[model samples]
Target: MNRKRTALSAAAAGTTAGVVGLVLIAAPAGADTTPPALPETTAESLVASVLTTDVPALSGTVAVSSDLGLPIPGLPTGDEAARIYTDGEGKARVSLIEGDGEKTLVADGATTWLWSSADKSVVKYTGGARDKAGEEQRLTDPAAAAREFVTAMGDESTLSVDGTARVADRPVYQLVVTPKPSERTLLREVRISVDSETRVPLRLEVLANGSAAPALSLGFTEFTPGAQDASLFTFTPPAGAKVTDGNAEVGKHEPTEQQKQDLLNAIKPKVVGSGWDTVYVGTVPADLLESEVTTEDKGGREGGKTTGLDLVKQFGQPVSGAFGTGTVITTKVGTALVTDDGQVAVGAVPQQVLVDALGQK
Candidate 1:
């Protein structure tokens, strides 16, 4: 529903890809059942059943890809492994292993934490934290996380029986979900594979208009439900690790009028030539331009000044990925770097923030 919540879903979807890949290998193949008996269940009812079922605790890997139809610059395409455990109390722990290090994202029903192994740091946020902070943030509850898929189901009436399939050796019913007539978006249809016996969704495929390929697909592997320890909902920061309370930080940092003006002033003239130019105090200095270019590693033999200018023209805006490429930048008034495609930029101010500052004059 919210951007942060959407991001959490995207992150979870990305992580679930790896898990699906591992479990898909064990899935069985068979001819499509002609007009298989579709379950007479509503999307809400089906989702509720999955949440309450005594399924086994799930653990597996996932891979993700976004920006399906459109081409976005600096986005990485790869697979990430994830392991998830749910205790049916609207709580879950998901650990994602990407490359050499692991990132642990947990929702203890109340708060969410994204722990990075490389930095050994944890960024914590609660549901209400974003509201008090007046910023978008991620959802931490396991049920809330799963609801992303259910919400995306669009119109309930568009759902229809597709066929039968097997996921992780379990027979599943394939149901095609389409957008409601009232809904207007690029998304055309979504196909969900549900466990035939349990009626829980095993996989979801999103198809977009004008695209031959489905935009995104996510699958849940090793589905299980049982009594889980209460400790699963609690997180103890690692030894010597810095704990950041996102709520406190948001409360402490309120931009002043001058600060806002400065940010606005920083972005003026929007278009500066590729080469360096020294503007006045109110103007973006040529050296500052060079610095921006150099910092992004987009400079050329002459330090990429011309190349940076070309990029500006191509993007029709000042492109800043100072944090990294995959990071999504969203801002209320300033720029925020998304570390991963789904991670919200917490403390870091985006390049636009400086641009806005320069525009103040």
Candidate 2:
């Protein structure tokens, strides 16, 4: 979930136009002086002008390099190229193809879906209200997107000054966007390049903070405006695909008290020996463990109980359950099953299997 959330936030922030403001700073030496004056524009006006521009539908290829402070534990460096398309209304789609595997994401005006070709699964998000509210907050609220621009130039963000350099042969306006100090992520500053003549943003660079790497850049290529079709926004679940509604209740199941105790016993040794001082356990996989059994909870009259398992631990590494493939993490006593909730679950998997899997490393 953290990985998914991070990717989605990065993608959304990358494509959204209203967060950053265009400001006219003095051009560097030997730049074109004939370009229009940039100082007269305000942040709000610049955002409005870009949003209202009637560009044709667009198609492009984008390359993204994600450095999450450290390398992904199991995956590669996480650099990949994706096909991207955007309509004039801020709707965008991105698809990544690698060998026989693919991942697709569509952000229509109202909803966003993340589709995994390998799993034949889709994660849907309703974004119409969210986008609108986010837009308003970005434009009007002091702590929203592009809050950095609000602090640096305030109302002057709308003013556009000619940039000193040309990217992709188009005249560029260097725009600086600053996120609020209290923003959720580590993003410190963003620099975007907007077309001087068309007022459309072409490129963006984000600078972060800490030992966690500081900078990541995204460049848009082969931009074509107003060329996308409306049908691209819709998605149909594939045949035999399992559908999960994110907004729905996660469902609950009841397990016997004895089964719960057995489950705790199975994981207790692993937790005690886990090097970490604190751990959170939730949603354990019960199928693989003999000591634990998952049964439906019959707490209420509506007795269609869902199946789930829970184990608590004070020390272990955080683990996620979203990975369809199970992962074993080393602990002080031995190895433990790290569940989808970043928790260590005892009896979620056989202790021997956990040790074997960890030993493979």
Candidate 3:
């Protein structure tokens, strides 16, 4: 088998509307005003409106805060900011602030660029080659995540309006998604802040079971909705920056578009189960795992016998079950399991749900 790296890695990073966020300063201690009146719609109607609402082209700053205690390398933690811009044509840009460095993502029509200021490296992709409009579309980011749950409501999840509040100084409705009694998940609720006038999702908060705080939160700290410049969606490698095609294979040839589609169709994973307890399973090639571990070793102490799971457990708790011993890593928003038999399961449910998922084979 010819080993090849597809553009799957870039799919998650592609749909970002390149919007960087600005930090808001606190107002005077005595400043106060009555919050706007609550919206006059039931949760179901509000959710329906949100799903069908087409957010206008605009640029704004978004804040992402996560307490998911995963040791996943390169996972951004704490309260970080990003500037997101969208042109209403599915073209968007995201500039992420990472301390003194920044990582920018610009997604044009059929191409995307990932640039890192720290390393001065650029990775270009050939767009979302998989079923992006389906399973993968929901993971675009936190703001989009709220829209996803709203669209996915009505069946496995119960939708209700948790009333209204002012977020980012705008009056909005709080749409909440609560898992049904039969749904096995750790999430207590997923709250979406929808701009009352625009019906666009302004923020999302994911709260774990029995937790008072959000495990994962994403929303605009400030928003200025309007037409964005055309330049935000375009990118050119800066002078002296290294560039690499995302679909470049190991051999001397580049994979054609048809080849990329074929590769995606070949390895397309299947989703087993439903609702919050869903599991994604696919047969990833051995070289993919090998390359992943090798990359990790390049950063850690040389000659460590540990593979990906070993390194993952260093930051998570050790877990074992009949589904075969593997580490279970839990974030504030969800939990995941990496089985010894090369099967992986992730969701907001507890570790046992993953064990059950691994047994489905």
Candidate 4:
């Protein structure tokens, strides 16, 4: 999807991680059920596939849809689609579908390049490094999303194979992963749809605890398996495009421990309750709107950025919580509360739940 690039949005949705425990619950668009349903595998095998599956080279269109009940500016909210190609090695490309122009990522195993069509800017990273934006530098596929979902879990998370269905026109096994009793995450369950033939996760969705809707969803709207053209992995910056050395320019200087603490204290909200009813208590930057999220202060591009905060101001509506009055942003997935005093609480439940969670504090 057009992922929100700001830290507050990340804190609002990310920080928790999934496949961020997928919440969307929808029968596959063209779901199919046939005999020999998945050869009876266990959660252990599915988890194994997430870690060990050797995804084959392929090319297709991926569509990520969101209803975060929040306003995300610059970044598309409803659907962020892209055409991707991978070599099954370390080479890949994603040509984003944007109206202004195309945004592409190409990795040739040695150095990766990001060319933004809208900006006509190219950022290059050598020795296989990440961008200043702190996004994955290497070729990351949809299966990696499933892997992240599984990898984020501890041994306590419960796992099960719900049944069989068709995703992206292929027969697949639906695996349900639930957080353990002790895990304090707000997520209730994550569903991953794995290709029965290849064990590749074609779709993923996360839901908040006791919630009926998916907080997030990522899936391929189109599919084409097998090797793609070799040229797709190649990259050459357009003549005269502003190219920055992504890795070198990123960490111009390191931060002191106190600066690190300041950042932590800035966004790190305490968890007041656990499971689906869980609430987070923290302080959003009083300067969320006024400050600059430079790379130096936040370290990660996601942090210290003001674009996302502006979106929050643009889209977030006012609401009162137990912590007192503030703003609330409602998405198809969950709710976020930022009080007048800068106290922040967010969860998948209703505003009242956050109020109750604040009361516990």
Alpha-carbon TM-score of each model against the true structure: 0.51, 0.41, 0.71, 0.72
Ranking by lDDT: 3, 4, 1, 2
lDDT (10s digit) by residue, model 4, range 174-207: 8898877665555678889888877778888877
Off by over 4 Å in 1: 1-62, 66-76, 109-111, 125-127, 130-157, 179-187, 197-199, 209-212, 229-231, 252-361
Clashes of 2: 23
Per-residue lDDT tens digits for candidate 3, residues 140-225, read: 35556776566665578888887777777778888888889898888888889899988889889889887798888888777777
188-211 per-residue lDDT for model 2 (tens digits): 455666656666666555565443
Using lDDT as the measure, name the better of candidate 1 and candidate 3.
3
Candidate 1 residue-wise lDDT, 1-361, digit = tens: 6999999999999889989987777664432334445556665555556556544444433334443432344442333336666665556677767669987877776787778899888888788763442121122122233346555443333656555666544666666666565443345666677776755566666676566565665565444545666676688788899888877776678788898787656633333211111111223333443344432433423443453333434433323454333332332212322222222222112344433333333
After superposition, candidate 3 runs with Cα above 4 Å error: 1-34, 106-115, 119-143, 229-272, 280-305, 312-321, 341-343, 358-361
lDDT (C-alpha) at residue 201 in model 1:
62
Q: Which stretches of candidate 2 lie over 4 Å from their true place?
A: 1-56, 66-78, 98-100, 107-112, 125-164, 176-190, 207-214, 249-361
Please list the Cα RMSD from the true structure of every candidate, rounded to 1 decimal place.
Answer: 16.5, 19.3, 15.2, 14.5
Alpha carbon deviation, residue 284, candidate 2 (Å): 24
Give candidate 4 misplaced runs (Cα > 4 Å). Answer: 1-36, 131-140, 153-158, 178-189, 207-215, 252-258, 266-268, 273-278, 289-322, 359-361
